[model samples]
Target: MTRESEALSLRVRRVLHAPRAVVFRALIDPDELARWWGPEGFTIPGVERDLRPGGSFRITMRPPDGEAFHLVGEYRLVEPPERLSYTFRWEEPDPEDRETVVDLALRDLPGVGCELHLEQGSFATPSRLALHEEGWSQSLDKLDRLLTAEGRA
Candidate 1:
């Protein structure tokens, strides 16, 4: 994993041992997304998605020891096996929370697999940026494990 952070934005890069198409599918497919979409110990109880530009998605996330919460977003761009972008906002946001844009770019690695570049921006504060950084790091770790376990890695 490689991470780059600015005061109000973040970038994370990970090399996945799975093909680009598979990783791209995992991002937009509700079933596959629910299986590995959150930080460690977090589970997804519900996922509703339209999977197209201008469409929307709502994901219910259950923490290890708290009430479930939701994250809602609208798709901005969705190009299969290559790129995706969306607007992300918490349904019930913290005072510091603000809607942000998340962009994902997937590059094929030939014989190896694929590289995923994730960028999210314009946080209200550095603390908010830090929080998202941790969440995304753990979530990507979980995704890697999922793909490996399924023998796609």
Candidate 2:
């Protein structure tokens, strides 16, 4: 859920059914990210990554019934299993959209799994922030399921 929100920022925190290191790997690894990185009904067909500070990354997301979307980002920081920071922008950005920063943090939770803390934005408006909130909520739900079912796949 969104931890807090202001005119220019959004924060959300979620606990996943995996360890911090495992969740971190899923976020940084292209193959694993492809499994659960978009809104519900959307699938990521490809990802190219250079997971180091200042490195670039690209991912193509295909919705079941819409045109594909391309997202490009540059890593701002890579702190292994604990934190990641990046800049996010769409290749075909909306007229009102601009590059935004996203910071992801993972904290170990002993026997309860791992905590994912996501803080993103400076969205052009509250509506835009709402859109991101919906998207990320669905995507994170997918991530939870993917991690829980990892042993089966």
lDDT of 1: 0.93
Q: Write the per-residue lDDT of candidate 2 for residues 63-84, one digit (tens) a residue.
A: 8998888999999999989999
The regions of model 1 sitting more than 4 angstroms off are: 1-6
lDDT agreement with native, every candidate: 0.93, 0.89
| Weakest 10 consecutive residues of candidate 1 by summed lDDT | 1-10
Give me the runs in candidate 2 sitting further than 4 Å from their true place: 1-5, 151-153
Q: Spell out the clash pairs found in candidate 2.
A: none
Q: What TM value does model 1 have?
A: 0.95
lDDT for model 2 comes to 0.89
Q: For candidate 2, which ten residues in a row score worst on lDDT?
A: 1-10
What residue pairs are clashing in model 1?
A: none
